[model samples]
Target: MVRRAKLVNDAVELVPVLQLFSTETYRRVYETLLSEWRTLEELKQLYGEGVEEALRILKNAGMLEIKWRMPSDPAGKPEKEYHVSYTHLSINVYISLKELNTILNAIFMAEDEESEIVDRILEQIGRGRISVQHISRETGLDNLFIRALAKKSLKLNLKGQLVEPAKNEEV
Candidate 1:
């Protein structure tokens, strides 16, 4: 019987990437790929089960590139080695207006201190203020957290000396 391919929508694509922040296993697998290429076997040895699905998700999101392929055993089945396509994958996320609204709404609804900081950072960036140093000083949040939240949750891209939201090409 032929297996149907899983349909990936915007939310589905975002889940794996978002999980990198909260899930230890996903974070470890992603960080490992950041340093060097690894085969499925090697990833399995290190991350055990769920590594395959996690790699598939990242590959679908355009974060990982196949480095090479070689036979895993005498049967000669090809095992592809993979590595991060960019040093910074978060910058590659394509956030639609809908996704951006959803992210912002979540931040607004959450009572956490970090959420408030992120909201302030977004408000500052949306107003044509793109400097991380400026946002950090204004929001009183750490520079690293502001940068990470902007790149990861808000899908901002660092171009030259400025960080801005990933342009919605569909617009």
Candidate 2:
């Protein structure tokens, strides 16, 4: 059976929920759950392995609601069903700089290829905010990967799929 709950309004707490919402997979998952309930298996079939992380993000962001349902057999284990916790979202844009700093950490050399990705993003967005798709085309890195790097770039600001130079600040 499917469930469609009334859209609930919840003001977001901070960057993670807002940031996760900007992701493609997260949006797709949220859309999928809007009109129907699905077991993990069902979601996995649609999204493959990416569903796990996406679901985790949704759950952590208070955007996914879950309930357990009994299986067909009397002795079988119950199955977990999932749906959207809220359909409406609002974000207050007045976060403190300290909190913003927490989300917009300076890009660091964490591993191989990170520098390359950061370099690419920096080079591409010099004039203005550029689409993640454009950076993906130039760097051959996936959009999601580039987004992850952009979030950490002190020199960059991420707004949805767009990445731009950090303003009124020295790097």
Candidate No. with top lDDT: 2
C-alpha TM-scores of all predictions: 0.43, 0.48
Candidate 2 Cα outliers beyond 4 Å, as residue runs: 1-12, 96-171
**Per-residue C-alpha lDDT of model 1 across residues 1-171, encoded as one tens digit per residue:** 222233333333444456454557767888898788888889989989878666754654557678557665778866678876545323345666765655444333333765565567668888878888887777776554454455444345544335676554310
* Model 2 lDDT tens row, 26-108: 67777888778888888888877767666665654556788887899998998888887666544436545654453444222
Identify the leading candidate in terms of TM-score.
2
- What residue pairs clash in candidate 1, if any at all? none
> For model 1, what is the alpha-carbon lDDT of residue 114?
51
Candidate 1's displacement at residue 12, Å, is 9.6
Candidate 2 local Cα displacement, residue 159, angstroms = 25
- Kindly give the number of clashing pairs for every candidate: 0, 0
The global C-alpha lDDT for each of the candidates, from Candidate 1 onward, is: 0.60, 0.62
